[model samples]
Target: MQPVVVPEPDGSVRVAGRRVPRGELPSVVASADAGARWTWDDTNRWYPALLAAGVRVERAHDLRLAHRILRRSALASWPEPDAPPGPWDTLPPTPLTAARDEPAMLFPAPGPGDDALEPDPVAELAVQDAVVAGSAAPGRLRLLLAAESAGALAAVEMFHAGLPWLADVHDAVLTEILGPRPRPGERPARLDELAHRIRAALDAPASLNPDSPRDLLRAIERAGVGARSLRKWELERLDHPVIEPLLEYKSLYRLLTANGWAWLDAWVRDGRFRSEYVVGGVVTGRWASSGGGALQLPKSVRRAVVADPGWTFVVADAAQLEPRVLAAMAGDEVMAAAGRGPDGRGADMYAGIVASGAVPTRELAKVGMLGAMYGGTTGSSGQVLPRLAKAFPRSLAFVDEAARAGERGEIVTTHLGRSSPLPGATWHEAQSGAYQDDAGDDDVAKARSYARSWGRFTRNFVVQGTAAEWALCWLASIRRRLWALGVSSSALDAGAVPAPFAGRPHLVFFVHDEIVVHTPADLADAVAAEVEAAAAEAGRLLFGDFPVQFPLSVAVARTYADAK
Candidate 1:
């Protein structure tokens, strides 16, 4: 059964067209069957409130996320082809938190003719359901919508629960590296010393700040170092005393600015680092973070992520997700066989390629596979790609075919039926101009180059987008499995843990293919099994007997840094 939730003026919700009091919403949400999808106007607005109230819904059809998909997807047709977007298109995901770490104001100041509060959510959902049921590939589109909505729920839950953070540990690491956390508005003593050394090496006045690349570049040139830019790679080749301190300065400066003292004070609160997550933010269907640098955090600071006193983290990451996805997508038996480990558990795909004689070495095999999927036609990667094609012809040809179609400006769809955006007006004009009666050779060459560049994007898009879908399926399966593991009464109720996850094992962190679960100490082994089981379930759900394995590198440990 689907519950069409409409917000009522009385601060209650009309659930399934019946008035449900706001205070009683949790019980109503809890009574919803596991498979029932709660159709709402906007999940970012509705779900966060429910999570805060200790209610968690299993499935939902986020009208906002679903509308974006249907309105543009080549697979869906019920909303009418090329329909002009109205108020829906401009309505962005309500931010979970603003940049200042304060709760975001969900109710927006409406623009002229904007009646968002008065729209019939149930009617909109009916239209969406019809579009999916009448789609070119209903099953696939429906699956994609389900998975995307699941991701939306998970993202909000993660933000609300927050990642366990040890502030002292983070500060200690910073002090050890920077020689002490400097006073506010002052540089660390160690960084100041490095700045002095950089200035001395360049034989410049102390006024030339190393932090300013422009000043440092001119100073380095004046000192006869022949430096082009302050980029680390370009600086490393130069044999000069300045290179060492300058590079060190750059590194320390980055740490200081990106995740140093200010970051700690801002992001970490009440021992939980709550980074706002943006579901489906990336075009490839991968997640993107908003406030806090959770997704972009460096491994060095990972030690700060320590579990609670009586709990441990179960960290798991899928091995070579995109490559394995490509294998399953193309039905490449040789590639699929290589995806499994030598022990039949899991294998490094690059290593497996080497074992299959794709190239002379693992590194070459890795580059060759990347080049094929990424559309590299020259360089060392290009040189080794032919051998890889011979070893796994089906996988190579699959991406190559997508690239050709992209070159012709055709839309490419992901495995779960998410269609790629078509080329813009400029692209069509470029291609068309190249065919004009008096077109110049340079125009033709430029058009061809642009085509290859976009082709590369499409080639990688198909594989990456499909990999993202696999991750969604994987996480959704893990979520269901976790919910099945009822909260244990034996352990102390973890009050610091948020609603819905307080007394149970819950997901704390998620990257593209990696996840970390915070679980009670006694349940560590069980959680690990669940993680592996979910990986298998996700694989089966996507490819169903394709023989492609999304094996994980699993580790159970007290600190996140301890995970492999």
Candidate 2:
């Protein structure tokens, strides 16, 4: 039977009406039946300890993640609890981390005058079950919950595995670009030189800091550059000597601060850069990093992500994921056909649009599609939108309806039932104020702009959110395939690696649409094949029998930069 692990006020767990001490929880989980799925209040709180104890769980139902989904999803009519602000309603996710030395604190002991009751995971699970069963689309909601829980597992595992990093290589790259590291609160040599050059070019005082936007803007106006801001694009437009050094300073300054020597020391240890990945952190279901900026690694430092000896990195990313998702969601065969190749594999969707004469060039096709999905009503994108709408009316209409729903302050859901948040009270006020008898033109224009901006948000939310679902399914499938591959291969020896994943290919890094698997060099080819198969399976799981292909650009290399 599946077990529901509920944390007690004293940090013990109640399982099957018997109390399991916190110390023995790992062994109990490890001894459960092979097909058992554990339900818990928060996976991050419980699973990390289980993992540290060398116990691996095959399946889970994360109550916190599910509750967030049900409470916001428009398809589910979740009933409010009898007591206002129940414990489950206010429960927060346990913070994620890469440390594995000890079990996470599951629940704090109530102090004097602390009357808050402990949250009951079993109760929350039952509520979620009822909500899902009585919902408009139970199957889809179930799939979403499962995928979300699986994503949590993947997130913890990736942090445990950690990305391979070569500190020496990273140091060399920084030295080459930033002219060596400097003391804290001091600029690097190259940055200092750039600052001096910028000052000379602007004929400004030496005290003027190039890093300060306000100070730099004042200096630029004093120099008669006629620039409004220090933005790169804005500065590039002006014909002035300060432009080049100023831009270079900004670029190097970002690298020095974001991923320079300081970051290397704090995040990387024992040749691994462990970043805490927060699954479903974004409202659209995309991940966010709690620390170590894992999702924003710049190209300048990618060369430092070197695989271990006798191992390689298999990097794969979906090509044009969102647009292709739109095609499938709208059931626009014309749009889908543009991405389908003669061999039944996927091709460049934008290129296919060009071939179909939807737009004259590939660039225009790309811009037009971006405009349609993102609500770009101006510039070159605007000019090409009409042609695209004429060519693919179904796909265009799909987003148009979503945009219109947002304009009227309606909640729009993704294909898998993750709904966009409702417009705030301020939005309602602005909208209502515009219709008042004494409302002026300014009120009307302000309301119109806010409505359009919100429309843009909802228009992209459906496509982007569905694309995130597709990515989550893709990640879960890849994890299963990689584990199975490791289990089936007898020759693979993980003795040199860490426990729990010693003889297995494991996911080390994941961004929105890309994944990097660190695997044995001999299994690189097989891993590549599995990765492709997993992408196909993800498409099938999300859109059964739909011809919208989720083709990936796969590469196997010793380093991340080389893979690209």
Candidate 3:
């Protein structure tokens, strides 16, 4: 393939030769070698406009995202020993088109994350490619980058396509749960009644607000209750007439504030809720929503997610994803065999553990495995831990080593080489103070407590992060398969979806280990098949020859809430 450069901010700057007009970008990208991988500073900045302009690429390397991975990855071999780690370490690289010395993208200042053009992105790409190629595990890292880049593309597409939403249904659900919509500056009727009951039972003044935690705590104290806070668990322990009403009030209040009428007005537009998803937002590689709370659609509001006439939603969720992932990554034959089961169904891996006679019961097996992964050291989970250890020692040892490494302030990496974050300077200072000559027992205890707290985080990181990678693979596979499946044969689309996504089965929503596809009714079964096929493909793509499998509970329905 020949290299052709067009340097007019249309993502052809990497080749560094000539300029191309904005209107000509589609033709230029189209004429270039079909297999050429476009190198860009950031996919979010450049790709969106191109996609809006109806241009898509087969392959591309996002330099900023790739650089962030390769530089710190334990699997990569950095050729530049003395290179400064500044600027690139920060999250969300600054936009290329932003003005100098001004607020640009993610961060509001002109430092670290704000400087998008240091060390030359082109040169950085070369170094990263070299390092990854020379790494001990190049294939895993390479697949990770590919999967990550594909995720970036998928995120943009999802944002553009948007999730089909019905404002009327959302309003109906909110009204059913919250009573009539209150007037401006007024509380809902149900919440108001609960607040009154809470104050009356506590013998507080009629004007006392149950929403204010401090005021409610004072009221509880005045009522001869031992509660110091209005937290749910703390309130549950208290035996008071106001406790039940207060808990109910808090629950209704949260739902009203989070996804009530105002949310519908702001988020729902043209029958879609277009959430801007942040790719790799979490440290564990999970996607986070910028607006609309797309990732956390509670069951109360899920009923609002209804497909258009003659269209349906294909919902699928991975079963016991983390444990299945652990089974494959650790290469533990016992756990892998259990994960695969007789029919390659990963249905409740903990149940499989019990059937294998690793533990006495399913509940014990469940908590024991959770304890092993999450560093639980007391209660029912801790009691069953020993039995689980002897049964699946390899998988048990994997997380145990990670936890120990974290306790020593050492960074542990995921299966795909994303390293756990280092403890902050304040954390290090606390640890240092504990080690000093004048340090007391409390200081050391506090330090150890903090270390163990972080240890729990790192211990869960490997499994969760690798599970995230598998999800990316799954999504990418589903996207490809649906694209290959083409439009449904009935040749009708009632959804009235936007261009590019119209007449197509498109991904509408995704949470951890679960996804929903909005498809024409005729293609609903096809989408479900693709979703299940993608899960199996994801398992194979990540584990290769491993016996472990990832299974999905799938449903094709007209509404999101009906899937479960």
Candidate 4:
């Protein structure tokens, strides 16, 4: 492997004794050794250009992402830079935009005080290397950084490939559900009808708009309906003439605003829907969508995600991911055994819990497990917690310890060392006020409630954060396998599909534990096998030889909705 080469601000690259001119970096990268890994300030800044120029790098070290991990990781002792916070310290991930036709340099030429703001990728990489080397768990920390950087690359590639979408299908679905797109500021025909019904039921005047929450609430109260909020669950329990129409109005309104005709026009282009995927956008290390609501695609709109003529989508969703991760993290073999079937393959862990007599039914087992991980200590969850704890003491104790630590205002680290943020000053002040000499009962009660809430946040943080790490590993592994598979396959015609991913099975969509890979129809089965293999590999990467299983529900379909 060659040493990491840093690109200068003027688009020049300096090798041993040679200088590559501006605008020639792409070709240089394309011809570099396959094993050589590129170290850049941000993958979003550099990879897009390389991909546009028909160039692809096998590996990369994203300094910005690595710095974020080391800055907060409890396992690493990050050395603060000598100068004040630079751009690398505060730089946001560049969002992928539909209109970006050219690549922008990450670090521009400095002028006056701008020198301090300029990021030095070589220095940043050195610092990250040193931090990881000196960390308490160097191996795991290294793996975490690698997976995170790989995820960044995959994110850029997915955005570049875009998700296969049919605008006609989307328009048709919207028209059927909302009764055609509304003109300019007017409501759809169906929404207008539902609004009128709601108004008549509430005995309100025609001027009342059902979209306004305050106005709707006031009208509901005036009509003698016992409703405090417009929430679906809350309204569902009430018996009133207005409840039915009001609920229906709210449901369709959400669909119209979130993924309606306007959204379709702005997001979907050509034959695909391109979304900006923010890696590590969530503190839990989960990805977030900056635009396009890619993470929250409603079921009504999912039917519009259609594959190309000769291609199909291989959708794989991990089953019981967080619980399985918890079982492995706690080294609870008993809990892990529940996820194994008679054939030694992965099975439903909740059913196994029921069979073990931990709970009377599978639903109770699921609720109890969710309660244990999420700090739900009331109602059905509360009722089954004791039995679950008795059955899986180790797993239950693991999250219990995290929750207690949170209540005490201590930071809890995930399995791979992504630590939770510390309690704020406001939280500390509340806790202190409760213990004051003249403190009243209200103060104590308020502090206790605040503590419990923070406890819940931390209780789920560890499990969710670790699950995200597992997901990153899963995506990274699948990405490499897909590239290799595509390179080795001969049946694919590179011209039939989009550039860069013309002949390959490429990842198009990912949310939490699920992923959709667009591939040739003939290779759909192979892609499904690889997706399943990646889950098991992610498990081993995180837990080593732990007997926990990370099973996937794999499906091959032409549309995203049918796969589900």
Candidate 5:
């Protein structure tokens, strides 16, 4: 029950603040003395500090958070091992550069007794705390959406700044917003509108010459103002006259690139629009796009994406993918087995992990196992995983290995060949030196650490990035298949495919880990099957061996929520 401490070679002991058996002390201490730092927990900001110290420390696979707390609290006074335990050191540190400071706890002070009060003072205190928290960062409520919006806005701002030609377009778009549509045959309604706006802006009559490149540029500039400030997600913004045309162009550009004019010609014949998606496009593995609004679909437009008469959409996903991957990686056999089906068989890989009683939730199963592997130091995985491991030793071993490697400053990699490199020599001297020493907090050392972290990032990138490639291939494959089917039929065949997604599925919508193909309802199920088969085929094509099993859950539905 006592805290773990390993004496470092430099005289100062690198304490784990975790439980250590007497027999293990000498080796652990020896490792610690060799400049090995304890990986307190996964969230420790001190990782860079450890790397800087020239410590080759590895995280203890079995350290718990509670034990870490006990150690930190005990070590809070430094060099003294008898101090009372504290909770702060067990948890991760708040980075100095973070936008907001941690909130303080609010509790009712000893006031009049609440036994006879109309309302409890404690409840009022809670409300005050909530308000304070909200006020501290009201934008946090929409931070995720806002982050994406910010990226798009940045792109637009950058484009506008770099492309002076766009100003004329913007001016034209503004003029069009205030002008009326023109009669057919005189000029297409869209061009006519643009002409009216350009004329008004110049204070004279002018018309858009469809054949002139300069005139086309003017027309585009006029039509683009609607989307200039896309952060306004309100319904009113959607109704703006300039908005639709700009979106249409953007969408058209994407379609044309993805399929070429040939595919677009065919899509027009069948009344179905296809969209392609890019998964794991964001650091968080959320979907993004090279082109098109793959993440954004208005319901009004969505309704128009019905499947052709005979097709149905078969949509599916791997249930609890990350959780299952964690369980498998952690070596939790019981959890892994629980991922099976009924009759004591593997049901869903994730659900089985839950059934194995390793953790109540799939996320916990993964996070907890990771916590354990990373020297959770203070019983961080809680009581669940340890107990589950009692019944599933095989499964837990993988996590133990990762933890050991991490503790040893060894980079762990995925199934692919991607490997992370060790930190440069500069980081070592800084840790051995004083906090104020020239070596300490050296910008070069800090920058090196950042680069080292990016190297570690590449370790995961191989697996996730390869997966993204497979998804893209699968999409392209199914898209081609669909096109071929349409071409063979008399009902569909015509126009040039759009860009970006040319020769690929018109990826109408995508979120991280999922895609929605806008195919005819009649062929939706068939397309879904094609997608599933292509995904599996993609795995084989890339890895040669299955490596890990790749399975997907598919569904047919009329609404996005239906997939859920």
Candidate 6:
């Protein structure tokens, strides 16, 4: 390894005494020390010039090592390996090049045709502002900025991949980060009274008969309350003032449904209400709704959640999960190990990297891997990732194979029946025919090719799909546990039933991957334990030890934010 420093160039400063502009300094010379040799294929007429320069280059069948060296050089501005709370969007596309932003060539050849469309710079700034607004406070803003930026970038990637839903989710996330500022003279409405009524409606069945599922359903319907609509009204009323009327009118409709109340009622049956969720259910392999409103929840109703008299709700989720999965697939061991727990000990698999005195947040690991997996050949993540692969072979191999296949215009999948198909004949013809005739409509041909090429858009569907199943099992399992713990908090106790234990609580809410149980403060621990047990059992039921370990880590807090 060599430490070569090039001083910052001034206007018309020389590189090897050839005048260059400022910000462009002496370039570092590098060589591949291992793996496959490297080669360049000039589709853009750079081959003749490079040959003329007498610059030596080698082409290897597997150019992983040489490729990595080139990748590292591109990542010069990335954060240091030990930097705390590293940038999330480390691989964002650079907009300008050279002094005066003129495009300059570092290599012997001019670059290939640029594929990316120039982004609206003004819109990008507004997006950044929104991220700042949603974050907690001034102190927390910087860290959040990086995360939000990365999320936005990931959304862009998804958009390019033809996944509109994921793009929406990321957009929503951006809005959430830059949360709405407090409106003057308009305080949030009190929902406790409404919460009580909704709880009563939710509880009607228990009063009828504890064990009879039929009686419970009938009681629930008879109550004639629209809990879901009430929730919507409450949330809209608190924030978006204009939508209040529509929200209220919508709730009115729920009150009229013969099956609406019954739907809520059935969910609470058998002393437990379980909802099913589907992950990667969408064509782009993102999560989708199935039996319940698992993807969306109205928060006003969230507070009504009371544990069965004695039990408590326990919640947990993996952090920056997909990036870790991608790293593992890429055979970038440094990244996988960075994302993995040291000796597999804690909730954050990347906790090891943070603990080992490298970057702390998973965002760093995420950014590093994202750059490597995508064609972010010139960024910090690209540079650091190859070294990471060298350290962690098994995991890196996974993502590397995926990337290779992707580069070859191949689709790849996990060890399941779900698979990707290759492009049809139309794509092959467009490539060949366009070159023969001078009247080549490149845009039309590319569009046709893209449609045909969609056949090869493979994903590790097994992991994503099965992961969704696991979430469903967890939701159902915890819902059951909470129902068994129901305790009446109301003085009317009108619809309340006997507590599971002498002082246990009841289950109140079931959002995908999360459960809310309203329990007595003292019994919180016991209730939380039950929730944990149920979640673990759910994972076991679905996967049955098929190599990867799906585990749950829990937190017990007074509020939703606190729990997180």
Could you tell me the lDDT of residue 562 within candidate 4?
A: 98
Candidate 2 per-residue C-alpha lDDT over 4-94 given as tens digits, one digit per residue, 9 for 90 to 100:
9876666567787889787688899888897787898888887877776777788888898999899889999989633466666687767
lDDT of 4 by residue, 245-314 (tens): 8888898899999999889999887788988999999998999989999999999999999988778899
Predict model 4's lDDT versus the native: 0.86
Off by over 4 Å in 5: 1-314, 323-336, 343-346, 360-383, 388-412, 420-512, 538-549
Model 3 lDDT per residue over 369-461, tens place: 888888888999989888888889999999998898888888888887877778888778889989899999999998999889888988998
Model 5 over residues 253-316: C-alpha lDDT tens digits? 3333343333333322323332222222353233454433535543323333433333223455
TM-scores for all candidates?
0.94, 0.96, 0.91, 0.96, 0.38, 0.38
lDDT of 1 by residue, 35-119 (tens): 7888887788777767866788888888888887777787877554656766566568877774224433333324544444456
With a 3 Å backbone cut-off (N, CA, C), the pairs that clash in candidate 1 are 341-346, 341-347
**Ordered list by TM-score, greatest first:** 2, 4, 1, 3, 6, 5
Structure candidate 3, residue pairs in collision: none
Find the number of clashing residue pairs for candidate 2.
0
- In order, candidate lDDTs are 0.84, 0.87, 0.78, 0.86, 0.38, 0.37
Compute the lDDT of residue 145 as modeled in candidate 6: 23
- Candidate 5 residue-wise lDDT at 27: 48
**What is the total number of backbone clashes in candidate 3?**
0
Model 4: colliding residue pairs: none
